[model samples]
Target: MADLLDQKVQAQSLVDVVAERLEAAIISGTLEPGSRLSEQALAASLGVSRGPLREAIRRLEGRKLLERTPNIGVRVAALSLRDLKEILEVREALEGMACALAAQNMSDEDIAALEGLIEAHGEQEAVREGKGYYQESKDFDFHFRIVTGAGNQRLEQMLLGDLYYLLRVYRYKSSTKPGRAKEALVEHQNIVAAIRNRDAGAAEGAMRVHLRNARRYVEEQLVEEGEAVVDPAPRKTGRVGSLR
Candidate 1:
């Protein structure tokens, strides 16, 4: 069991290749959510050793993109509204804190950079809303810069870890949702506006609103496409807690 778990991580090359391939598969829907992964079949297809494949699987499992069954092997984890809320709850708090810190610490250059990202996000949305390729890479760099420069190593690590699967899920689902590209543009503008104002309280509030809207939009898509089950929690506004 230990060896199987360490199989992919043993070599950087193998791990990188496997991780990239698996992520691509998930995002392309070539490896559909909830579809079982056959270790041997994938090993052969990728032309990699079983050890490396297992290691890649372990990494994906850690990211919550894949789930391990008891002696039955692995499958893509189903994204549900319940899980979305739970993940978003944490994401909101951490991101809010990050944005608050950014608001206090951001330099003039940082502010300009962020504005550029917001404008690029709008451009991406405009093209996509017209049924063109939705390019969100520019928007991604904005969040990356904020989290990395927030002077919180632990927070950076956590955010980086979630980004892998989060990007995959977003690229796949957002492409299918008609208005998402445009909505994302507005959401980003709101976040940028709060940060530029340097209002920590408002920054945090705006960040939460941005994330909650994204969560709601994504979950709505999942439900409509028969991909997830919406599970509502009693209003927790003004209330916060942890879910280990």
Candidate 2:
């Protein structure tokens, strides 16, 4: 007899899809912090029953975005400098690991994609003058390229998952400063150069420096903005941890 626990994977519902969408909504700043999610309204808008919507909200709660209040249901979690630092630190480690592996395993096609992506998106003028959304997407592509290049599926998903949460904070506070975008592009170049030379150590070093710089910058911003509490709330749960 088949064990009940080992049953085949079931199909997910529209609720599950909307849940991920809502998760991204919160992660991308579409859903503002402290905003309350209305079950009736959301269900109506999404054209779904309350059951899936509630389940979805509960899932978001477990991820730390929607906190369950005693009588009041839930509100979107607020961002803080402390939370950003912790997230970025974890991101740094995973990204550094990706760079090291990419240096050794990146194929010619992967290298081409990286180079092309940088060439198209590396223009300081575009990042400095272009739409913030474009820059954000560009940044995402670069990071994704590295993760995919690394040939480590698990690690890749983990890194990108953390960045999704970070991106929400980024969209709100102008996380990457004016000159910082160009600097980051240069930093990406440095990492790529090391990879091209097949210097895993150098690639890892460059990647770490990049992530550390990002973490430090965001940390400073959080403090300067006065959102830096004495002790910030702990993360609910990582949005996504699996790389692949």
Candidate 3:
């Protein structure tokens, strides 16, 4: 009886577990934007009660990964190209700030770990195929660490909680463009070099330039495909901080 009670307390609840699985699917693009989330189907597929499934969805909704309509029920959030530009704008400032802080605050061990991560990325099959880039998630893992290393709790939560996931979906969609992967690798190296030297200004500048190039690539693709590019010019948001 004691063992049973202890196990009950120790095991993850169905809701939290389900929420995590659903969140992963969303992030991985397995559940594409605007995909309907049917409660009945999801509960049946996952072999869970509707009650727990609903709870799981509620959690995802809080994370901004799901949206519920009055009569239509829940679906994954879809971002417009305009929305993408706006998001990347926020990412430019926030991540640039993160890079700057990481240069100042990250420990020597952490910096070494980042170098090792970059080295590992260089060995990926994609890189060897002359693709020359880390997979989307692997690439994000590098940025995620830097964001966390910033040591700002609110900033960490804002980036990791919502914006990053949305960015991942878009980036995964765009990752297939020829030559982009190779270009991203070069930019990643530049950002890392600046951080290693503890040049906060250089680190932030490198990060902005990298993301700007990425945004430009997306814009060029959209234009080539005959889609309207909203505000193609990148705006200079005021400096995030005085980078030392």
Best by lDDT: 3
In model 1, where is the ten-residue run with the lowest total lDDT? Answer: 235-244
Q: What is the model-wide C-alpha lDDT for candidate 1?
A: 0.65
lDDT string for model 3 (1-244, tens) is 1111112212468787777667656654557566666676566556677887788888888877778777566777666678777788888899999999999999989988988887777777765564324343433477888889888998888788766656765554454357777667778889889999999999999999988877777666655754433543321332111101
- Per-residue lDDT tens digits for candidate 1, residues 176-214, read 567665666676677778878888888888878877766
Clashing pairs in 2: 153-244, 154-243, 157-243, 158-243
> All candidates: CA RMSD in angstroms?
9.7, 10.1, 11.2
Judge candidate 3 against the unseen true structure and give its global Cα lDDT, from 0 to 1: 0.69
Candidate 2 overall Cα lDDT vs. reference?
0.65
What TM-score should be assigned to candidate 2?
A: 0.63
Better of 2 and 3 by TM-score: 3
The runs of at least 3 residues in candidate 2 whose Cα sits more than 4 Å from the true structure, single-residue gaps closed, are 1-70, 78-80, 123-126, 130-140, 157-174, 229-244
lDDT of 2 by residue, 212-235 (tens): 876676567656755454543433
Report every candidate's CA lDDT.
Answer: 0.65, 0.65, 0.69
